[model samples]
Target: MQEWQNACQIAAESAWGVTTDATSVQSMAYDAVRDGTSLKSQHAILATHRVADTLRSITEKHDRGWDAPKPRFTSPTVVYDERSMSFLDDGTVSLATTEGRVSATLRLPDKKDGYQQQYLDDEAWEHTQSTLHERDGAFFLHIGFKKPAEPSRQPEYGTVLGVDLGIDNIAVTSTAQFFSGSELEHRRRQFRRKRRRLKETGTRSALRTLIGIENKERRIAREILHRVSNGIVAEAERYCCDIIAFEALDGIRNRLPAGDVFHSWAFRRLIEYTTYKARSAGIRVTRVSPEYTSQRCAECGHVEEANRSSRDEFVCQSCNARSNADYNAAKNIGERAVRCVQQSTQRTSVSRYALKSGTVTPDEGFTPRDGGVRG
Candidate 1:
């Protein structure tokens, strides 16, 4: 496996430095792995595929108007399809290595009782590919698979669950649920203080310990975010919510100082996990513009910056309404999501009429002017 990764590393470096052309890079490095190494012919081909994938990603990023630099590999991982690996009956996986084909027993975690049968059944679940990686002195296998998506049992009439993600509490829901982190925040501050002390000491051991602490913190944060997301999704399910709404929080860092506070908050990961879990349970996830959500009053259609008296307080000057700032924002997000859905439905109807009347054109498509429904 190490030999295979070394070959791939060479191939990747060649692809980035020598030429961006994947075919030429593959052709150049193919002989090195094929003739000089003990790696099988198929394994060598897979190495070339990895090089091609890296080059393709760079090219795609550039084409998308990103000033992407040539990528250099930082870690070694092997991607294998069913053709290059096999799953044994006794819950073991056999994969090709540079030495030879080797088999390993998979130590899978216990799954939910109801999902166990469905996950093990071939008709409902299908393994597509797998990747093997080493992390923190442990080898792990991440397998991708296809499963039958449950039919959406969306409620015809149900509440909208709004979630506001922030650095203070991690997440706040429209249902007045607060996932606080007072203790967690204090622990993180302790970690930060320790990190500063280690940096001041400037010793090799301290630096190494700092790195280990950072890794440990990251793992803890990831696990906590997963739990929080799960709880949010579970809340939505409990309330019989039809839609889970979140703010479109792209480029928010540019608007605020991106220090340790912002970096430590795993808002994006929380949302990603929440949406994934919601989708599996047939819940609709919606993103609405976050403009003035915090300032706007959920009790009334009042909009003013002064409505936000403080970071954690919201007292509307117009209607004298009061609530938790994050809760109000979450409520506003839910309202916006409802409006967005309504607008979308209106646009669909208008487009259908235009199509029937032969008024729709291929070039211009549909515009805001084409939509008749307006607030």
Candidate 2:
């Protein structure tokens, strides 16, 4: 049994179907054999492979492209429902569930020496539904378990990180807003140009080649987000900061002008993904109203046409303040989240109890948890 540690991992939920392919599982088992490890059961191998890949991915993200092995944390537990069929059931070289244990952790007979928790650690965990997705031929279980805790006090929060999310670059944070050089921008621009050319050459071979292009784009985009999110969270952690804040950005896509292409490339998806990663790392993410963050000047709180000098530069005419366009926006987002959190804490609330001993106090809209809202 291995020692249990606090961790976060993303489980694969295929976008297309239920049940993973037997081929994929068999390949993984063979790889296990090649590595001098005995072959584990199919389900156990599946879960282990997933854990390895997800952790490896996140490491490269924070390491800034340096090669590193994936970090290991937990044992994979394969699960099934009451009516589910199992080849291992009724005997025939199949493993059965061990008794008196949490259903999520599966014990592999092969790795009789795998991670076994001595006892519950008093940490509260919540099952976060990663993606309501499909795989194989049907939708299967793919839930992520993470430690959720209450934060104590906030950071000085003197410096705010403003973030503006867009299509190619999902999130252009304050750091990138002020520090990213022309190299990064040029690479992104070149990628877009190559992608455009790939689309125009629409033959069967071209279309086939586009798949690789698409995968590269997807991987690059995912990696960029990983790096940006890691950098932001790392900076917060370095500064002893408590809250990582941004706008709710709930419906900005729909609010855009008609035929706007930004809708095709979802910005909120990036925010949601980044928040999940940020929250898991213990860096709290706050959301504020996204009404007029851009138009308003961060320095003087002035709203005028002259504030935005160009697409990339912002100059406040009211106070003669000048800064990168995105820096101002990131600061705006940080300011809003900080103000919102402060205001939210000051509001009063009374718990109304029912006469009946077991009557539940309805968790109206938001349930108060550990002093922060989780509902």
Candidate 3:
């Protein structure tokens, strides 16, 4: 793996040197340097492919008027295609190396219903490319698979559940469930203080500790996101919702305060995690325009800046409706989602809005049906 990494780096540097600009990147002959490496022919070809991909990415950024720098591969990782790697019948992985082919046992979790077993037992999922990398003095292999996506459900007859992401709270649902961000913020502050102290020390040990701290922080954040996303999906399922709606995050960072810049990535990641999880549960996820969602009154359709009394409080000036700020925003999001779908489908006879209790309509305010309120 080390030899392959070095060879790939050298080949990529050579490819970078030969290619003058973005226009010539596609037509450039990357295969000319294949014979110059000690790696096997197939591995050498894959290295060139990696180099071409990197060059293409860099060139694409440059084309977009961004000052992107050339990429350098400092980490040791080996990319493998179908021809260079195989899963043997004996439950071992055979990989091509500089010293010829080598085989290793592929370790997996013991759980019978684990993701690895789920994919392995299903013949429909086809294995594709993979990457082998080292971390924490241990080697790990990341395998990719592909399967046909299920058909998406129509939004016309769907029950929508709106989700509002905010700095004060990690997430708020139209159903009145809240995932507070206070604990997360406290942990972040603790990590920040520790990092600052370590930086001030300025020693080799401190540098190593910093790296460990960063990794730990990332793990904690990932775990928290996974939990939050799981809760979001569970809430949708609890309400028998078919569609989960979120505000479009086109310029969320610009809208957020300068100190809350870091939370922008968390917001995006939460949406991504929820989308996949909801899809797995036969639910559809969609995004609606975020314009005036916070300022608009969910109860009376009134739009005014003063509707939001504070960060956590919402008081409608027109209708005197009172509710949590995040909950009101989530309700507006759900209403907008329903309106958008109804307009797109041209269903003028009846328009339905999803609420915590049940579906609501213009004619009936809130009627009880099947242990839930319907309008």
Among the numbered candidates, top TM-score falls to: 3
Q: Is candidate 1 or candidate 2 better by lDDT?
A: 1
Task: Return whichever of 1 and 3 wins on TM-score.
Answer: 3
Per-residue alpha-carbon lDDT of candidate 2 for residues 77-164, written as tens digits (9 for 90 to 100): 3432222222232222222332222222333334355321211222375433222223554433443445553332223222234465
TM-score of candidate 1 relative to the true fold: 0.52
The sequence of per-residue lDDT tens digits that candidate 1 reaches over residues 1-375 is: 576666677777666655544467778888876765677777777777777667755654543345777555557577777677877889788888766688998777657544433454566677756788988878787776766433322232334677887767778887667898664566678888999999999999999999988876766666677678888888776654667888886633433455745343576667776776686666767778888888898767699999999989999999999988988887777667666665575221111101111221112332122332112
C-alpha TM-score for every candidate = 0.52, 0.48, 0.57
lDDT of 3 by residue, 37-130 (tens): 5677777666766766677556445533457776777787988888889887787989888778889998887786568867766888867678
lDDT of each: 0.67, 0.46, 0.74
The collision pairs in model 1 are: none
Every model's Cα RMSD, please? 13.9, 14.7, 11.7
Q: How accurate locally is residue 68 in candidate 1, as Cα lDDT from 0 to 100?
A: 75
Kindly indicate the candidate among 2 and 3 with the higher lDDT: 3
Runs of candidate 3 exceeding 4 Å displacement = 1-156, 345-351, 362-369, 372-375
Instruction: Rate residue 222 of model 2 by lDDT.
Output: 52
